[model samples]
Target chain A: MSEWWTYRPSDFLLFVPRTYYRLLEHYGAGAWPWQVAALAAGLAVLVALVRGRPGALRLALALLGAGWIAVAWLFLWGRLASIAWSADYAAPAFVAQGALMIVLAALPLRAVDVSKPRRLGASALVASALAYPLLAPAMGRPWAAAEVLLLFPDPTAIATLGLLALLPAGRRAALMIAPLGWCAFQGMTLWTMGAPEAGVLLGAATVALLLPLGRTVRRRRDRAARDRPPASPGA
Target chain B: MPTTLDRRTVAAGFLAGGAAAALPRVARAQAPAPLAKTIPSTEEKIPAVGLGTWITFNVGDDADLRKDCVAVMAAFFEAGGRMIDSSPMYGSAQAVVGAGLEALGSPKPLFAAEKVWTSSDGPAQIEATRKLWGVPRFDLLQVHNLLSWEAHLDTLFAMKDAGKLRYVGVTTSEGRRHGELEKIMAAKPLDFVQLTYNPVDREAEQRLLPLARERGIAVIVNRPFQQGDLTARLEGQPLPALAEPLGATSWAQLILKFIVSHPAVTSAIPATSRVDHVRENLAAAAGPLPDEPTRTKIAAEIVKL
Candidate 1:
């Protein structure tokens, strides 16, 4: 389970642009990349929270650096002026920022204390709330909904979210249900509006939510095992 | 009396030979007539259908899949097909095709056309394409989708002049840059031009097909079934009664025949992942083509659907 959550943003980013470029070409939209970037960044934060791995943060940063270089190439060398302010442009920027946040979140800012359950719960709630807005627009109606569904939040995001939601305890339930509910609500709204973009956004967000929810469920199971007394001999 | 006897003996010998020749007379047989028109490239006439190696054969590193592809090619060859068009852009298709040919004992393909897809390395691109196909000189070398065509054309023309390549051409699919293709064909001397032309996408018929015919360049039709979209559209629909007279048994045959029946279309290269499809596509070349009126009727039938 822990093994599944670990992934580099760079690995996913390497192939994402190729698909993103194709989508941009197909739909003639400029804003698709921005949603993708925001989704990527949100995913990095989610991974950091679940795994507490500093290396994952570094990998995310490297991916962002490469993604920015690609953006520069497209704008300056390719002379595709539309890409400069396009959603494609915004996507990588969000990814880079998201990766940076993950690094910050992973830093050992204070002494470790296992007994501080209340503080940890409060911090988790605060982090989830803060990350919600960053991940929200990528899930709602308008602009490149189909492409967002097909490409954004990508496979890595889904795997990370699933890992996070698998952690032990009631917190796992909260982590799993909140994102699923948010996605379902967003999806319903998008459907009502006849907005395909909303559906695409919702799909990406659902995948993103799965990683954290999975990790949370897994953590809960582990904590339950540790807390439970050993089985009596011959019982 | 002795001199008279010698003269008489010579006359008797001539008389015997004449008598032997007069025993029976057999009528001389006439020689078989030659083909009305000579094929441009080789003495052997090429079939109107060709094969395309695109996404299907481009599966890389999977040995079992590669073997299946080789079997598909063998089936294609057995069905009396010849030409194969591939590109460097299509992953390992060229390599896979080459391996298939090697596995099948390297039967000589009538025509092999490859494309240079990228910029910045004209010579290296050509070299790599040659190495991948294991052909010393390709029959046709085209500039793929006009990606850096200007730079590649110079190298292609040089290769053609130097006998490194038998023919030089350009290809563009997906209805992209039709005007550019027209401009290049108009200004340049090319032996062939490849483009998409299925029933659904008849946009190429308005200008490109006519221009190729006028320019006397061989035309190769790609995506003859609109990349399976046409097939999906006609799924469960029976072959029209009119297609039987034109000798088309299936939709694949009907579509390929329509593309090849054009006076300018030298061949139509339809990519297929299945051997049955390759055989079916090749069978389109075996019989009489639909006449102009019949073609119009077929088109009308399709449009009505």
Candidate 2:
């Protein structure tokens, strides 16, 4: 038999793009009105995160965690597994991510950072809620097929990255792992199917991955400035 | 003698008469009887066109899509086509095909062609695949993509020797591993060999086709449309005037004709979900096939497009 590396991305994708989009449409149809609830829940979570109270952070984590579990059940297992066999394997990862979030929610809330990174994260969360659903319509698919925040994995993962950004840099990286991994897998799936929507997950993942590096750079610069002797006062 | 008026005789008479009456209606719904080709090993004749279940029938547990697949299968059988090919690797396709066969009342003419894909546990996997198809025995079971062919071929030949299978074969697709495939075709006592062969992808025409002819191994052509890419590419182009003589109305039929016209090809399995496309594919087997010069013209025309 041929080696595994000889295969291309297209080889792994069993169905066509239309079939994939139809799967989303079927999922949307089955989980109707809940999509609206999901969008509202996402907005509520974003609001809670922006407020940055200890209880509010817990509430945001709890909500995002529950949303991840729901998407795994409704979309990944219930709908996607019907078409893509790997969805069964993928659903457990989603469940694990959900479990992780809930566990984190029970922990003590650390100091929140209301910096540029946090603002960027907030913008991403807003996009997940408001702009994500419009992507289906933008791509000429029916609105019924729109991928709503907290209702689908992509937007939910992006929203998680957003909320993670609001936490201290040290606490954020470990939590970012699951959502970033999901983004890569989902992005590759869509990319292989030739769907331009892959960019949404990939772009969010790239930015989320780089945010900590950017934060570390700014911290090192600040520390150097603070430790530097008598900033030329003698001169 | 007076006809029997007993309940058993009366019921038997009604069933026989009803089946006789319903047979022609099913026949009339399809095109003319599909063309048949001879299997050199046993001289058994099968339709030149067959149904393929690669991506088309992988709709897992979806009742609506399963119904669609049943409709396609029903159309295929009504058209007198057999030799439905599938593999375990095609997601839920084997289950979908099983469901379709059950839904169609397990048509008697079904030529269940399956594959052994796993690197180990060939017998167990074949049994599982048999359960999936809901058939007593497969007409043919092949080593899928030549995976562990040495072991699986031994199992398959053993089954054939034990009368558990009617034929033994091996398969490859997308023109991959043709060298190894060629070596096996030359060495093994294979009843059938399937590979990708379309108008555009005619690499098999040079070696494998002639080798199959020499070895008396039947050729089952898969991806006759390059998994629908070739047809999609030729969609808007006009069928050459020569296609009129072959009674090909669509590009799918024209392309199928081009594949099966070769003397070495025993059957071409074109996978499709649409009812009309299945009928059209089977229809290509009907009427006159293209001659060699015409086959070249068909290939040339598709390339020019």
Candidate 3:
């Protein structure tokens, strides 16, 4: 019966920028209202995913995805972020973050099994890691503390790994730990370099790491086939 | 000899004279005047003058009336003129222009310029503009009157990188924000800037025009007659004899030629609701532009009018 029930995720994404502008103008520096709205939307998406309503989840993801992109774009090009940094610096950072969010949101994360969510999460993590180097050309700044501070870990990867680790031990120990270990290695690398380019190098390294794991999976499959008893004659 | 001067000879002479009389008419139909410049966007070399469909398109009967408007547009284009400037705030002008283009068989327009008005609607607005014009990419897009300009610039830059837009610009009219417009021209990398500049409103000549020249930004003049205000002022006045040297047949051509003569001005868009007016505007693009002394004399004459 409420208008909010009929709202779609895409609409929410578009609506957020307009709402953010008004709220930012009204509250100015107090961005709590925007953060709360974003959190609520994220919660709704989580609920939809748990309920197996893929359509709802997608729409919700799209909304938050586009909304975040719009916000980043505004900060990059509009008055808010332009006040703090030069247009040249602010704009590229906004573009990089917005592009990362859109790609993450559009990814088919819902299709991955909860039993093996870490694989998909790791892939996203690697993809975002590699995206940094490509973004450097646009940023046009030498790697500095301020530039390095802009590279934040993919939040979706963090959320997915956290959920997977909380599952039963057998699933957690075998499936979740591998991705967690990889992420830890990546985190360590990022800590040492403290530059955006390092994030890209770490991502490239993950792809190299996945190659050996793929071969192990293939060998295990072959071994399992050899051990299986020959099919009995029709009895 | 006496026999040759008889009825047959008289008939032959009459036919030859008729053919000679009809030759000029055929030549006039065959070769329309050559355009001043060919916009690199298309094969057609467009005349330097064009129509700006802002306020006039809004006052029309309805969107469907654009069918008639297409004829007005066709008159301009068919006469070797191109370029049409519109904005979203101009109500259904973009849609009407789109319709007109479709009705006219979608001839390759020399230049299509539109603007994004709202900060939040920048991307959608650009997308909508592309769709409305049925153009693969717009030749030029400006931030209308500096409204939400920064937001529009972001979308524009992305579009430009993707080759969805060829050029980006900003505009101001009525000489209201010359200061702000000048600042943007100085700070931002722009291809063009639209503003009001006529003999009547010479404020832009002092700074904005010179700055555009220095910056290499093309200028598109709008409200050249102050939306008919200058024409009203010169209503009863006869054409000055000095305009003859510039090949300006009427006050319209004289005024337009003056604006287009400026090195910074790429083109001038003066809107008209009638086909005759479009023809009159197009005539300014026919001959060589006014020189410095000629321009000064034209300005002095306008003061007298």
Scored by DockQ, the top model is 2
Writing each residue's lDDT as its tens digit, candidate 3 over B1-305 gives: 01001223222332433422321111112124424543322323434687788645533223334544665666666566668888776655676677666655555544788888854778887788779777777878999878777778888878888878878899887766677788999998888889989887888889998988788777889988877769878877898988887787878888998998887677899987666787778778667688888888889999876
**Segments of candidate 3 deviating more than 4 angstroms:** A1-235, B1-46, B59-64
Would you give the TM-score of chain B in model 2?
Answer: 0.91
* TM-score for each predicted model, relative to the true structure: 0.58, 0.86, 0.50
Q: Model 1: per-residue lDDT, tens digit, A75-146?
A: 322332222223344345434434443454354333222223423442353244334333324544234423
lDDT score of residue B16 within candidate 2: 41
How do the residues B1-305 of candidate 1 rate in per-residue lDDT, one tens digit apiece?
01011223322332433421321121112111111111233323556787898656754544556656765666565555667889876756888777666555554544678898864898898798888777777888899878888888999999888988878889987677889899999998888889988666788889998998787677888878866668868777889998888778887788777777777678788887676687678777666677777777777777667
Query: lDDT score, residue B207, model 3?
Result: 93
For candidate 2, give the lDDT.
0.82
Displacement of the residue A64 alpha carbon in candidate 1, Å: 15
Q: What's the true lDDT of residue B268 in model 2?
A: 97
Under CAPRI classification, how is model 1 graded? incorrect
Candidate 2's residue-wise lDDT over A76-101, tens digit each? Answer: 88888877878888899888888888
Q: A92, model 3: CA deviation in Å?
A: 42
The CAPRI classification for model 3 reads as: incorrect
In angstroms, give how far residue A221 of model 2 lies from its true place: 6.5
Those runs of model 2 whose alpha carbons end farther than 4 Å from true positions after fitting are A16-19, A52-55, A112-114, A137-144, A168-171, A216-235, B1-30
Worst 10 residues of 1 chain A by lDDT: A8-17
List, residue by residue over B81-155, the lDDT tens digit for candidate 2. Answer: 888999988888899888777655666778999999974899999999999999999999999989999999999
